[model samples]
Target: MSVHRSALCRGPYGGEGAAAGGTGCSDPAIFEVARHGRPPLPVCPVHLGPALLMASGVLWPPEIRLIGRVTGLRP
Candidate 1:
């Protein structure tokens, strides 16, 4: 038998959250793949709750981009 190791939530934002010692919240629920990478977290930034970044087969990039443009955030 073989077992695969899944990723973990760094934090609400990404690795920084993890580095900051954030354990992440349980609102929208974390998925196997969602935790594997950084950014596009499975939680709401406002409430620090779980949420899906995608909606109706479309990704919510505009909002993220806007944040980056305004804050000059790379990730």
Candidate 2:
């Protein structure tokens, strides 16, 4: 059972309700695969610039997602 907690991936599909806290957190927390935890939004703070302007106030697609060992930022 893969959990979304916000499950806010880079695509436009899964972020809606989870980002709005329906799944658990409007501001979901980011965790290492098993190491540490941080707030998910700031995890990809630079990526969130557009999200800030999106007027939707979703909780992800942020720069904090790029931190440490995330996969979406890679080529």
Candidate 3:
């Protein structure tokens, strides 16, 4: 699958313990994550951990899977 590196990380951020204001991470995306039949989301390494944790809580059996890697992208 073709992956876009231009998209910024879509992982939610800026909560009680995180820096406030921003709703998601600003880092460039490194992986394209697919959530079952839902549209894929771009996520960076920095937020991947938190994203997974959040997903595990929301979905009974987390359906999030790595579908593609953004070429030439690094954390």
Candidate 4:
């Protein structure tokens, strides 16, 4: 599913009366993400960091220790 031109962020937001399982964030999307055979989805800058971090963790497991070195983290 390609993201529409006016797509909003698909990140999770915390609040009451939010969509059944959706984030209440109505921020405009700044990026399009496609992963694991999934269609592209829109994402806003505010939520992009966490998405990228999660992707990194999945792509590079902690046991590898390469992520920390590459990112300049002490871990």
Root-mean-square deviation (CA) per prediction? 14.3, 9.9, 6.1, 10.8
Model 3 clashing residue pairs (backbone): none
Candidate 2, residue 61: lDDT: 40
Using TM-score as the measure, the top candidate is 3
TM-score of 1: 0.23
Candidate 4 stretches greater than 4 Å from native: 1-3, 12-21, 55-75
lDDT of 4 by residue, 1-75 (tens): 233546666643321235422365676666654444343444566665565454322222212111111122385
How high is the CA lDDT of each candidate model? 0.31, 0.32, 0.53, 0.44
Q: Tens digits of per-residue lDDT for model 2 on 1-75?
A: 135444432322123344533223233333311112322333123334433444233444433233333445557
lDDT measured at residue 53 in model 4 versus the true structure, 0 to 100: 56
lDDT of 1 by residue, 1-75 (tens): 012112333334343433532345432322322332344432224323322332222233322311111123476
- C-alpha RMSD (angstroms) for model 3: 6.1
Q: How displaced is residue 62 in candidate 2, in Å? A: 12
lDDT of 4: 0.44
Candidates, ranked, lDDT: 3, 4, 2, 1
User: Which lDDT tens digits does candidate 3 get at residues 1-75?
Assistant: 344646667764323335332355677766545554445555677666666665323343444455446456477
TM-score comparison, 1 vs 2, better candidate: 1
Clash counts for the predictions, in order: 1, 11, 0, 0
Name the better of 1 and 4 by lDDT: 4
Give TM-scores for every candidate, taking all chains together and pairing residue i with residue i. 0.23, 0.22, 0.52, 0.49
